[model samples]
Target: MYENMDKEYVLNTYPRNYVNFKQGKNATLFDDKGKDYIDFTSGIGVSSVGHGNARLADALSDQVHNLIHTSNLFLIEPQAKLAKKIAELSGFDVGTFFANSGAEANEGAIKLARMYGEKKFKNKRYKVITLEHSFHGRTITTVKATGQDSFHKSDFSPYPDGFSYNKDINDIYNSIDDETVAVMIELVQGEGGVEPFEKEEVQKLAAFLKSKEILLIVDEVQTGVFRSGEFLATNLYGIEPDIITLAKGLGGGVPIGAVLTIHKDIFEVGDHGSTFGGNFLSTRAGCEVLDILEGYKNSGELDESFIYFESKLQEIAKAYPALFEKVVGLGLMRGLRCFENVDLSTLINRAFDQGVLILKAGRNTLRLLPPLTISKEEIDEGFKRLDNAFKVLS
Candidate 1:
């Protein structure tokens, strides 16, 4: 069976739960044994338009049958179109650098910040300030950029320097020295207990940093691409970041990442590149995703979907305050912060056993990043399963 083969051949990197999905329909996934489960993860918010999407499948299939990869050596059609589409949707009149994952996008953004500092500051000002509990990625330098200590294990000791984690603006300012060049953040800290930064605080911090000429980098890797009811989560704070890193949901299940530089051109030829970054297939998939999202937006379906997602979570939290005392996050990216005595693992497992797939964040936050294309009926079914799980626990 694939399970045994996966256990034997695949690297034991992930927790690798007992569930093995065979296929998916909208927000529902079916196990190999034919049991159905309502998916609330969206593969950690990657499948923005839902799985088995006809438009996405058709686009990918056409791209597969035609052209897949041509590297960056020559011009690619979908890549160019996707870049322009991002510009149209985001209103960022700047260049975009393509990469393959969130880590790669963050890495590129870091390089851009450092490059900017190197060229403009006349002095060495390459240090980037990040917030505590922020999750960037798994790459070595990104691990260093991540604010969590747990990700900085002994195995990857002596992490690459030039990054600092701070909780408040005073702490960030205090930490800034002659080497500080930029401050990176996520408007909605998805992994950090689904915490949404207040717009006023974000505006204040952004203004302060701008006064110092320090660039602002928003890691929209998890919060971008209409996941938070906007083209980009950075728009929610009304701040135009010097650099925005996007991935996860951009490709709608395809592996693709991007670094969008807003009105700032720091990279020249031979500055940065990725081998499999902006391949034809990935860009084509991205185009289809945008098409689907734009369709949803135009038809008023997207707004309706987000309203349902948020209202259901709020209702559920109110219904089961013992298990989930509060709800946090914007749009579909949500979390239920548990009470002190609630065991997160038990609750997650209970939900999984009740034919529902879910995720967690921070210590006790039940994170939910369901597909944006999820229907109201699917939402009802998922909440029904969640109610069953909460009933067993509370």
Candidate 2:
């Protein structure tokens, strides 16, 4: 009934599955019909901690009872606390602006980058360099920034210029001109399939960009919040990015986005703002998420979880070599690259049918991003279901 209602009233934007998930706990989701499905996608990496998280729920509940929202004009405590926490965790003296989604975070990053470039360079250094198969957002400017041709539809004609696509470092270096201000990249291209950049390559790029005064913006929307076994993916590469955009898992499940301006005061007064961003509720949630993740990290639970998840994925990859050609990803954010002959679409459908949720990416890849708080037992069960699903395909 809700699915039909969605089709009739809601905008036909996302190509969605027919499952009506009613509730979830830890790493499992239950559809409206009461069938349980192991959530390997984590709602596309948004549910970092987990679903129905007691800590987050309790914190938000208390927050809602006390205060819900005010505005950017006034001082908000949760927002302040979250900003401080993020700045400290980010490993940089940073200023943070909050928004409501990953797209908004990326948009803010782009704006700050453009402003900084023009101010420092004394020219219109507004052009940005993104990579092929990169997806920034659905907004007009961000979609234009996206490198995929499928997203550049004729419907949204007259695209905003100053964005270019490059495949490799040579192409990026060659493409960088006087007008180019920044090169935005995802350390692990989550949506482009779970592809991670070489650590040395990223360091080289950072060094070159620093030499040329081109800011490096790291989009940690899908890969942040311990998704890649680190606080930020940039930490894995040992690079200090000029700007970092975060959403998805920052608030665990709340709709919140953050743009951290590191190394300097980039955005001045009246530069950029958001209405409902960093509200009382979302900030409380974000604080709880940080506390929870920090607790896990201190107890050595985070490290153990990362290692265990990778081993489980390795087990599956070895079990079904033909179906899962290789396990490719950073930490818990992983993918199973399917062989050419494997029925990718059918396997996805079968996984759903077998009560295991998953996602697809790239040409033929099974993207797996389970909750950071997911238990080893849940991982085993999820894979047990996946193994059965693969057998059906065989």
TM-score per candidate, chains pooled: 0.98, 0.97
Predicted candidate 2 versus true structure: per-residue lDDT over 1-394, tens digit per residue: 7888999999997888888888999999998889999999898899999999998898988998999998988999999999999988878888889999999999999999989977888777999999987888989999998888999999998999899999865579999999999999988887787888889999999999999989999999988877888788877889998999999988888999999877457688898899999999888899999999988878988889888888888988898876877888987889988887877779889999999989998858889988899988898899899989887665
Judged by whole-model lDDT over C-alpha atoms, candidate 1 comes out at 0.90
Clashing pairs in 1: none
In Å, residue 380's CA in model 2 sits off its true spot by 0.6
lDDT of 1 by residue, 276-337 (tens): 99999999999999989988878988889888888889898999877777888897899999
Task: Pull out the clashing pairs in model 2.
Answer: none
- The prediction achieving the highest lDDT against the true structure is 1
C-alpha lDDT of residue 251 in model 1: 97
RMSD of each: 1.1, 1.2
